[model samples]
Target: RDIAPSDVLAAREAGATGVVLEAGATNSHALILARSLGLPAVIAVAGLLSSVTDGDLIEVDGNSGEITIGETVPASAPVAAGRATPSATRSSAPPVTRTTDGRVVRLYANVGQTADVGVALAAGAEGVGVVRTEFLFLDEPPSEQDQYEVYREMADRLAGKPLVIRTLDAGGDKPLPYLPVAPEANPYLGLRGLRLSLAHTEVFRTQLRAILRAAVHGRIMLMYPMVTNAEEIALANEQLLAARTELAASGEEAGDVAVGAMIEVPAAALRAEALARHAAFLSVGTNDLAQYTLAADRNNAAVSYLYSQTHPAVLRLIQATVTGAHRRGRPVAICGEVAGDVDALPLLIGLDVDELSVAPHSLERVRAAIASLSYPECVARTEAHLRDV
Candidate 1:
């Protein structure tokens, strides 16, 4: 069964030590929440519910995705080979990370809530990479005032650090109860993100107004999700301008905010240059981009093997996105699970991404990995990887 983001948070509050789900994608919001909360989670466990009874003692090894049942292990039992035991301690990362060749890479945290901000700051995150605003609209869309309070609180907590707040990304995988949506055979490829926002102008405008109001408290950058074309960016910006105008007419003041686009669709990636003309910056959502590029559903176990962000095709899109944004003098950021991958650090740096936004828990490790890499070598490696593509 599919798990929600709030469900993961509730489980943590209820004293659950680990989570096992029969279904979920690696990039799913639930799994992301579990990771941010430091909860051990293993998803896509076939027959997980049927295999165990209520009273069965279960031991879960999240690192290895191993679930042991019906036996109590001795204290001296040997740990599985190649599997590292989980530790409660968190290592401190440097405030800044630079490549061996002296190129600096910005590291930010992808957070779902305000509480995650403290953890991200402690782990040396330069700023908040993205705040998944959809978490506040799960059951029902919150009132504009309520949304403003949450966004304002997040900004105040961050002080002057950049806060990249993504607009409500509902519809696919996360449909709002209050907002009726016609069922679709393939929701991921259907109305979602910016498409859904555009379809429901009232809801989208409400969110934009709140984000604009909250920007007064601190540095805030508004990012629209799932934008596929220059036209989508223009449409979203129109809504934003309307929100600003409404606020002005009401004698309410709003802070300045930079508008950006999320490049999650392959079509968007292919036309990144065109999108850059309308957006202040571009952030690549590699998880969705990879799946959409490969025509693989990330949530489906059958096609999971095909969802590789490092695939040549996916890399080409990333390269094109960076090239396009840079051409327009707009910076590009990678705010996906791929950004946190230690093995992919060199490729990302070589791709010349301006920022890397990963889970809060991965900030330290990713920073350390980047500090050890030579920018020149990374660039060469990236060139080699893109040579045939």
Candidate 2:
């Protein structure tokens, strides 16, 4: 059955224990509420509704993202390409973050929603690479205190692991019904990411305040998405300063916060050094980078083949980004689909990605894979393969 947020409440009022929904609605306001309200949910299964009749028994395992129908086990658990279930693969491997050859590569999780934090941590994420804040506000933005309480709970749960929060990245493909968005000739190239946040300064300010307030609970690093140049980062930082000032006047305590910039746009990747000079850290968003560099829309199957993180050009941008960040003593984290990819592990390690953030489900499999690779061999191979003339 379709479970909207209101439906979650209605279902609860009817004394339903949990809800199973079509995978497509995971980002809906209701699904977010389901998790917030402590209701278990399983999403993204084909033939989900059809498979179950009225009052049929189903087991929704939110942790494993699995749904079992009518006491029958699911035929297979979802797994990453060329990988097995994390539990199946865990063979007494050390929980420490390191490779077999002694190179330390931190494994983080790219959490799409707040409920994902538990799964990511349970899967052994050392820190949070990116919390896609956009998923928190599906239908409309939450009030300041609502945002604060939610973020505060996340920070408290983290209990000291680094949390990098990517401020609301909306517009382009992800237009909000509550907020009006103009039709774009190329929405991907138009007002998106920081551009949209800049357009709605008050909303951004509220988020900033919430994040700032939440920082008091544990480590929190604020970051902006889709930043093209230093000016945008500078302007956004200026607003952050205002948020801090407002908090100070309101007698609120915000922990010492660090600022970061996402190097997604080629312009940002190209001039990463200059931006690094102003940022506390930098992250490479390979998903957007690959699409923008290759002129391919990842969502469109026609150009899907071209939407590869392994392409030489995309690799070079990543190389340049990591090299620049390292030169400036700033750690570079990659929070994209590629980070979770087992095939791209060696290249990312070779590129010297300080942190690899992947989907929660793929975290342990990726960790197992990383533990099997040699840092020295990867660096040598990467240097030879991406040799710059």
Q: Give the C-alpha lDDT of model 1.
A: 0.84
Candidate 1 wrongly placed segments (more than 4 Å): 55-57, 70-92
TM-score of each: 0.91, 0.79
For model 1, how many clashes? 0
| lDDT score for residue 151 of model 2 | 81
- Candidate 2 residue spans exceeding 4 A from truth: 1-95, 387-389
Task: Please give the lDDT score at residue 26 for candidate 2.
Answer: 45
Which window of 10 residues has the lowest lDDT sum in candidate 2?
A: 77-86
Taking the tens digit of each residue's C-alpha lDDT, what string does model 1 give over 1-389? 66877787676666566778888888776787677666677888889888876545567787798877766546565533221222313544566779987898988999887778877887778899899888756777788899999999888888899999999877776777756678899889898988988989998999899999999999999999999888888899899999999999998889999999999999888899999988999999998899899998877777888889888899899989999999999999999889989999899999999999988878778887898899989998988987877
Tell me which residue pairs clash in candidate 1: none
Q: Per-residue error at 273 for model 2, in Å?
A: 0.3
